[model samples]
Each structure stands twice: as structure tokens, then as C-alpha cells.
Target: MKVVNENLPEEKPRHLLGIGEPEDIVEGVRLGCDTFDCVAPTRIGRTGTIYIHRNGKLEKTSLRKPEYQRDFSRLDEGCDCAVCEKYTKAYVCHLVRSGEILGGHLCSIHNLYTIVNFTNKLRDEILHS
Candidate 1:
């Protein structure tokens, strides 16, 4: 698996396989991987949890719990997707707690869009090189 990534042409678009670590994401970009995705993000989100980086420290918030019952906030401040723009964390948490499938679907869709946009930005960066 590593051999394939090591052998990928720098000028041709290639995807890094099975990258789940934050450090690996940096390495993959350095290796010229224009696209990358993982099931971890959505898998975590669907469980009423969220990943956050605060002061360089990673934190996971469990939204399914009663603590976030009235806490309304965006899923991600940097995310430009419709879900992030309009929906609140509290609402999503409610959906998940109520077993509403839309919660998972919305989270998955926004997650995919974020990944797609990130990859496109990387592709642009590669093209400019």
C-alpha cells in the first residue's frame, strides 16, 4: 500500500489510501494526493459526536447526550456548506436523539461536500505548481 503511494507520479493526480490520521493528511498532501476521504468523519458524526481542534488539541463532543439539549451552534465555523450555514448543533443533536435519519444524511452530505471542496482546492494548488 505504501509502495503504491511512494511510486505515484507527482504530476499526476493520485489518492492516498486508508489515511485516517491528521499527520497522515499532511503527509498525503506533501505526497501530491489530490483527493482523500474516509468513513470515520461521518461515522463519528452520525453517533452525535463532533471533531474539533481547539488550540491545536483535538476534542470530540458527544451531542447525543442531554448536555447539548439547548446548545445551538454551527457544526463547523469554517465549513461553507448549507448544513453548517443554516443548521445548529442542537438541532442535529435532537435529530439524532430522535432517531431521525435526516440527521445522518445531512451530516454525511455536508461531510462529503467538505471533502470534495478540500480536494478541489488541493487540485488547484497542484495545477498552479
Candidate 2:
């Protein structure tokens, strides 16, 4: 990707497909890619997994985990997404454990918001630098 990025003209935007992981997004940006699209975010969301930013790092979190069963905190602190605004970790965990479809919906909402916000931040940082 680095080599291809170097060879491409600056006017040509690089768009990476099926590369949606946090690390991959950052790396792709570093390699001069301008855009990305992938199903990994929604794919994981379907399984009750979501993404969160912590200590300046991005990580995956599963609502079905034991710890979340009693965790009454928001899915992601400081997130304004609808799911995070109204749902508790315990509630989401319970929903998933109980085999409810809402569990995945909430996770998807939070995960997609995280990913979009992450990429936007990355772009701002790159532009300012």
C-alpha cells in the first residue's frame, strides 16, 4: 500500500476496501489513503461487539462479557450516540444474553459512531500536521 500510495499522484484519492479495523484505518491514513469502507464493524456488531476509545487507543469490547453484566456505565464515555446516551452496559449485556435483536443494534450504533469519529479525528490531525 505504501508503494502504491507513493506512486499515485496526489490528486488521486486512495480508497481502501474491507479494511476497517482501528489499526488498519490509522495505517492506511499514514500510507496516504484518503478513504475506507468495510463490513468488519457491522460484522462484529452483529455478535454483540463494539468499539471504544480508551487512553488514546481504540479497542473492541463485547457487551456479552461477564464484566458488562454488572457494569452500569455507558458503552463509551463522552460519546453522544443515541445508544450510549440511553443504554447501560448491563442492559446491553442482558439484551445480548437474552438473545434480543436490540443488543446488536445498539452495538452497531456505538461502533459505527466510534469508527466515524476516529477517522474524522485522524483526518483533522493529518491536515493540521
Candidate 3:
């Protein structure tokens, strides 16, 4: 990404293909990428994996894990997404363990929101800098 950013004209928008991980997205923006596309968020969400921010770092949590079976906390702490606002880890874990479609949908919503929100913040920071 650094090489690409160095070679490209600064004024031209750079679209990064298949880059969707939270940390990667941050680095991509820092390197001047203007946009990104990938199915990772929804794909992993389908399997009950979610992106979460903790202690200033991005982490992946699998709702299907046994530890979440009794965890009643929000999906991701500090997230304002509807799923995070309305659901608990235990509930989502039950849905995923039961193979309910709503589990995937809720996870996808939270995952997408996480990435989009993070990207927007990065954009704001760059704009203000």
C-alpha cells in the first residue's frame, strides 16, 4: 500500500480491492486509499465472527464459541449499532448455535457498521489533519 500510494498521484482517488479487515482498512486510509471493497465482513459474520474494538485495538470474536454462551454483554462494547444496542452476546450466541438466520443478519449488521464507522472516523481525522 505504501508503494502504491507513493506511485499514485495524490489527487487521484485510490480504490483498494478486497481490503476489509479493520486494521487493514485503517492502514489503507493512512496510506491514501480513498475506498475499499470486500465480502469479508458479511462472509465472516455468517459464521458468527464479529469485529470488535477493544483497548484501542481491533479484535475478532466468534459468537459461536462456548465462552459467549453465558456472556450477557453487548456484542461490541461502545458500538452504537442497532444490534449492539438491542442484543446480548448470549442471545446472539444462542441464535448462531441454533443456526438461525437472524444470527447471521445481526452479525452482518454490526460488522458492516463497525467497518463503515471506523472508515468514516479515519476520513474525518484525515480531513481535519
Candidate 4:
């Protein structure tokens, strides 16, 4: 990314493809990427995994796991997405466990929100700096 940034015109916007992981996105921005696109968030969410922020880092939790069966906490404590605000890990887990499509949809919403929000914050920091 650094090499590409160095070779490209600084005035041109950099659009990174197939890059969506939070850590990767942060690094991409630091290396001069202006935008990114990928299906990771929704793809992983469909498989029952969702993103969560913990200790200032992003992590994934599988709703299909037995551990989430009774976890009443928000989908992500740091997130303000509707799923995190209105749903519990236990309920989402039940939906996943029962093969309900809503579980995937909720997870997708949360994951997409997380990435978009993170990117927006990164953009704000860069612009303000």
C-alpha cells in the first residue's frame, strides 16, 4: 500500500478493493487509502459470526456457540447499532440456533454498521489532523 501510495498521484483518491477488516482498514487509511469495499461483514454475519469491540480492538464472536446461549449483553458493548441497542446476544443466539433468518440479518446490520462507523471515525481523525 505504501508503494502504491507513493507511485500514485496524491490528488487522486485511493479505493482499496476486498479490504474490510477493521485492522486492515485502519492500516489502509494510514497508508493513504481513501476508500474500501468488501463483502466480509455481511458474509461472515451470514455464517453466524459478528464483530464486537473489546479493549479497543475488534473481535468476532460466533452466535452459534454455546457460550452465547445465555449471554444477555449487547451484540457489541461499544456499538450503537440497532441490533446492539435493541437485541441481546441470547436472543440472536436463539434465532441462529433455530435457523431463523433474522439472526443473520441482524448480525449483518451490526457488522456493516461497525465497519462504516469505524471508517467514518478514521476519516474524521484524518480530516481534523
Better of 1 and 4 by TM-score: 4
Looking at candidate 2, the ten consecutive residues that score lowest on lDDT are: 52-61
Pick out the ten consecutive residues of candidate 3 with the lowest summed lDDT.
23-32
On lDDT, the leading prediction is: 4
Question: Which sections of candidate 3 miss by over 4 Å?
Answer: none
What does candidate 2's lDDT look like per residue over 1-129, in tens digits? 999989989898999999999999988988888999999888899889988778878888888899999999998886889999999999999998898998988898888888999899998998899
The regions of model 4 sitting more than 4 angstroms off are: none
Better of 2 and 3 by lDDT: 3
Q: Which digits, one per residue and each the tens of the lDDT, describe model 3 over residues 6-72?
A: 9988789999999999888888887878999999889999999999888987689899999999999
Per-model root-mean-square deviation over C-alphas:
3.4, 1.1, 1.3, 1.0
Instruction: Write the candidate numbers in order of decreasing lDDT.
Output: 4, 3, 2, 1
Give the per-residue lDDT of model 1 (tens digit) for 1-129: 456767867587776666644556657887656566677668866766655445644445676878667878787666778888889878988898998988877676666665566556666877798
Better of 1 and 2 by TM-score: 2
Q: What's the CA error at residue 124 for candidate 2, in Å?
A: 0.8
lDDT of every predicted structure (CA atoms): 0.69, 0.89, 0.92, 0.93
Clashes of each: 0, 0, 0, 0
Which TM-score value belongs to model 3?
Answer: 0.92
